[model samples]
Target: MDRPELPLAQLHAFLVLAEELHFGHAAERLGIAQPPLSQQIRRLEDKVGHALFARTPGRVDLTPAGRELLPAARRALAELADGLAAARAAGSGRTGRLRLGFAASLAFTVLPGLLHAHRERFPDVRLEIREMTTAPQLAALRERRIDAGLLREPPPDEPELKFMTVLSERFVAVLPAGHPLARHRTVEVAALADAPFVMLPRASGPGLHDRIVELCREAGFVPQVAQHAVEWQTVCALVEAGLGVSLAPAGIRRIRLKGVAFRAIEPGARTRVAVAWRADDTSPLVAGLLATMSEAGPTAAPPAARPAPR
Candidate 1:
């Protein structure tokens, strides 16, 4: 069924004139002349089939109908303004929901800085952050389950994903608190050549896991396997338990953990983390977030690796 069109212009004039009670003042407020303001009120009253105002030679006052409409008019205008604001915000990508998948380890690294920057610029954009390993995050992006992701380097064979590097940090060795190697500010990877290595499973973050192994191999001897865990925190925890020493991202040193010692690795082996999104996705929110990251850049500085808790 068709609805009756509201005479918004006339209603606005009526509200202004009602508040001022004088046509000249109302017209001045509306940036119009008094003749047009009176005509607008007359048209509105005719449409309502009620005498909205009882006008005297020099005074005007609202009738019962005009009084009843004042509150509704105010509410309608407020709702319309709110609706327009919401539309503008969504159009500019300043507000709305964005699903983001990230590697679990990034919580301590670049993620915090990136999130803070985005929020500072677009506080209304709701971010749904999920922790997934790189492979799963890539799959999620391909399946359209998430809008974007932060993960290790993309697979060489996958062409559907686009990525931008946001961080690169060297690897550090995490050792048992009392281990002799912890006394050194820096240690050669070959020094841990025979040391049992705690590591993440191959499937958890293959790029990083294999990179650690590759670093070990480059040092002239294969690392002896000691223990394997899924999360970086767990890997550090195992290192703390004296289960085995492990090589982790230098950022992991920022995590406050007891019984573990961190030391810089020789030759400064570094790994990268990047933001990834589907190549075909032209979502403004995703674009906006990428722009924010570009502006925020990397965190100020990576903290120096420190020794065990004393």
Candidate 2:
């Protein structure tokens, strides 16, 4: 025969009455009248198909069937309570997973501090970080492959994504350590006008690439591209090999390439790093991260630009 479904209220009454061994006391403890408590226990006994208590005018005692059901009832209630608590914690974003995408160059700038602060505040939240360039990060955000992104120069036309600038840095020139201009405290943009340039492909990071080209135009000349690299480290490495000069965010100076020099540029150009997420996302995990970013402040100071290895 199939077992009857037991109601939680009756199980609660049975447990209480079993413990007190007095209907009047258990009813008082349960904040119900003695007659209702008796009804609850009787109803439970009917479902259980056995008398749960041996009653007398003076005292109450448990039957063997009641003894067996007692432990199982406690476990069921405890497990339900635990499950409810876990659901609440996940809904509040105190425990869950957040998949984030970031531009590789950000590691030298705001990435570490931001991640550290988030971990400290939401320790139970699992952070999954993916290193990608700006274009790929944007595509990932649109496709829901990532919950959030840390990227440079977020396009203003992306109405579907909300962006907040987390860092801004001025551009710096990268040159071969032995190049003549490497000896100067600062290199004028116009001075590199005739030099062959090593640059990140425009397709990978259009914003930064176009900004460099715009700065060159403002300096009354266009950069003569001699090579292209996909990452800042590679761009610096190519410059170290004497392939060409390049312009990069000041943070790129931290790469510490032995044969490359980083110098401040004249008529400074700047780039922004932003945190972005889909505007329509309502997940508390996303909200928790956005709140942490707001509390940390709108912008972080980039590492001070310094002359490197000349």
- TM-scores for every candidate against the unseen true structure: 0.82, 0.92
Clashing pairs in 1: none
**Residues 1-310, model 1: lDDT tens digits:** 5645568788788889889998899999999998988888888877778898998999999899999988888888778889999999998889999999998878888888789989999999999999999878988999999999998755666689888888887789998878998888888999998799899887877888888889998999888887989888898888888899999888787667878888988967888888999899888899999999888675433754764334
What TM-score does structure 2 among the candidates reach? 0.92
After superposition, candidate 1 runs with Cα above 4 Å error: 1-3, 33-39, 156-159, 178-180, 221-226, 255-258, 280-288, 299-304, 307-310
Positional deviation of residue 261's Cα in model 2 after best superposition, in angstroms: 1.2
For each candidate in the order shown, give its overall lDDT on alpha carbons.
Answer: 0.85, 0.89
- Write out the backbone clash pairs for model 2: none
Residues 126-219, model 2: lDDT tens digits: 9999999989988999999999999888887998899987787888889899999988878899999889999989898788888889999999
Over 4 Å off, model 2? 1-3, 307-310
- Distance (Å) between predicted and true CA of 39, model 1? 4.8
